[model samples]
Target: MASIGYFLSCEQFGPKELIDQAKRAEAAGFEKLWISDHFHPWNDEQGQSPFVWGVIGALSEATSLPVTTAVTCPTFRIHPAITAQAAATAACQLDGRFVLGVGSGEALNEHVLADPWPSVGVRLEMLEEAIDVIRLLHRGEEVSHHGTYYEVQDARIYTLPAEPVPIYVSGFGPQATRLAGRIGDGYVTTIPDADLIGVFKESGGADKPVQAGTKVCWDRDAERALDIAHRTWGNQGLPGQLAQTLPRPRDFMDAQALVPRESTARAVACGDDVDAQVAQVRAYLDAGVDEVYVSQMGDDVEGFFAAWDEDVLPALR
Candidate 1:
């Protein structure tokens, strides 16, 4: 059975607003919650980057639905040791309802510390080493690692969940997908590229869960909604230098400002009808995704929920 989840861009919503939304998602019967983990906002114009960990802690008390980071970069900005500790604390705080979704992050987000961005090959190696560090720490073991990318000195996590936390790797390329299969407890990706699963299996992943999502605005005024989404999130379509790596989400906004409106329109589905939004999500499921997360774009949060709650979700069930 495919579980349906709601996508929350933490950078877009304030802490209080996010908690409120999570509460509403639970009340509306959402089973899972997916939140983007970015260190920076899309641009100075968008203007928000609340710490994801703090927000998740609030969410734990705000709702019962399990939470997953849509994808977090395991390389660069934060060391695997620090991330392992944060994940452990989160798993404990969320009481087994949290999943750590990791990836080999882009240089834009990972290279902001004035450090030279590593090459893709190096990034993959870092990802491999980081995973080892994280998995070992998640096991609540006293970990001592000396690797090409990271080093941990007799580190142990005593506060993690009783069971090891589930680690899902987000991948797009063949090597990364194979790495996911070999190391990840499950796989996470934005699009349902059937080839991704094949890559995972061929690389080593077999019988792992696949989670994906599509974005749409449920608005009678389609153009207005598309305009906002493209203006705010279009950098998501860019292969490099994303909102994460950019100094601010608004930096992305400035960059996105260069793209033609049609480009943003292609990635986002905006419409007044609920069926339209649901169909967009259905297409992802049809692609063999095990979970479909719907990103509610625009300002009509109430309407978005009503449509999905009354029409889309029931039909899926």
Candidate 2:
């Protein structure tokens, strides 16, 4: 069966808001859950960036829906060695209901650690090594390693899930996609593009889950909603290589300021109409994703889900 999920941006709302939203999402019939892990909000104006690992703990107790990070970088800020410990503990806390979604990482945040950002190929190498380290630790083995990018001395996880923790790899291009196929238990992505799936399969992945997510805003006034989205988060729509390596969230604003509002709006759907929202989600399903997650972009919760319940969910069903 094709499953539907809800994604929450960890940095966008506070703990109370997260708990409330998790309850509301479960009530709305979302079967899966994806939460973002970020140390910083794109801009300080976007508000609270809570400790996501802590939020995941509360979420595990709050909802029956399974939780996974959309994608967490186990490179900088936190090493894979510690990530193994955290994920292992989280899995136990969730009672075997957690997936460890990891990736090569972005320079915008990781570079803040005073480490020089390497080239894409180097990042991929680090990611591959990180995966090896994380899995070994998850297997409850005493891991000691001295690799090109990481060096960990004899470590073993005291708390691990009864079952193995599945690792999901996020990829955007062919190289990363191929790496995901070669090593990941599953694939994680935002774009609903099947070419990515094929890349994974050819590289070695088969029959594993592929999850995708998109954004929508539920508002009574469509124009006003679009304006708010474009102002605060429009920078996300920027294209090409240099955009992903930004040093700060404000860099997004400055670069996105060069692009037109319509371009960003193309990625974010806002409506007072439910049919329109359903169609946006359908595009993801058509792209051959096994699961889809919808993030209602703004803070207007009551208004968004009411439309989803009345209109979108039925059409999808």
Candidate 3:
């Protein structure tokens, strides 16, 4: 009974391309959209990183699907106040069809302001504070506060949807999952693991929606698909906090040199095998995920969509 959503990669596509994909996804029966908000692509080869807010505005005009930031970091580079305003406007524009997804964030995007990156513990603390500020602002009141990580003086969001924007928190660990349960309207993660869902629900996230996303490349030639995933996203296979600590795309490129192509092939669902793609979706469903967002990773986006719409999606339904 889980709904399927399309994940639009802002790091890989230009604003127009993303809008176009959003339209195609809607036509193809995708029910919702998850969009990444990043200042930079994981690696240079992925290229384009458009300002996510502007793209959201364009998407408002282009599609009717509900949208969520698959996620955004509101603590650094951009203040929580500004993020609140942006999310409010997006909610208004989309007619209450927008959800704000937030996380502690990676150094790659946050270090742009030249601020010293805090440790993981500090980042999580900052995330909590940022969430507090955003929720307060969404109430449409003049908010003033001085907190451990942020300060606000008479800040108010003038434009907002009738309903306050729902905020979903993203995490990859148990502590963060608990935090999401305590504060988030919903939960988000990339892995399709039921234990994470149990963690979220056990703490306080019970009855709330849980979202998960995965990447796949649909090509007839499996080897070609594997090569594309490795060249552009091999860094994704990095372990531990390497993804969070890596500061630049070049740094990722250098680190990914050590990741074997076989690793990327094993991790990502590649090739035109309909059963394989459907299996990927089933994992999320089996994990009790409320929503599954899938991203097609290579240039075959059109082909991927066509195949999924004609085959995979029907099977899932």
- TM-scores of the candidates are 0.93, 0.96, 0.98
Could you tell me the TM-score of candidate 1? 0.93
Q: What is the C-alpha lDDT profile of model 2 across 1-317, one tens digit per residue? A: 67888888775788878878888888877788888877776655566678878888898888888888888899888999999998988899888889999888777668878888888899999999998999888889898999998999988888889998899999999999999998999999888787888888778788888888777877898888788677766766777865458888777657778778898678777757677788788887887788888887776898777767667777798
**Residue 128 lDDT (model 3):** 97
Give the TM-score (vs. native) of candidate 2: 0.96
Best by lDDT: 3
State residue 33's C-alpha deviation in candidate 2, in Å.
Answer: 0.8
229, model 3: CA deviation in Å? 0.9
lDDT agreement with native, every candidate: 0.78, 0.82, 0.93
lDDT of 1: 0.78
The residue ranges of model 2 lying beyond 4 angstroms of the native Cα positions read: none
Per-residue lDDT over 1-317 for candidate 1, one digit per residue giving the tens place of the 0 to 100 score: 88999888766777887787787777777889998777776655445677888888888887888888877787788889988888888888888988899988765566667667666677778888898899888887788898887889988988878778899998877777888888888888887688777788677667888888667766768888887787667776776435334554545666777777787777677867666666677877787788777777677888778777888788777
lDDT of 3 at 96: 92
Ordering by TM-score: 3, 2, 1
Model 3 error, position 313 (Å): 0.3
Output the number of the TM-score-best candidate. Answer: 3
> Clashes in candidate 2: how many?
0
**After best superposition, candidate 2 residue 144: deviation in angstroms?**
1.0
**Rank by lDDT, descending?**
3, 2, 1
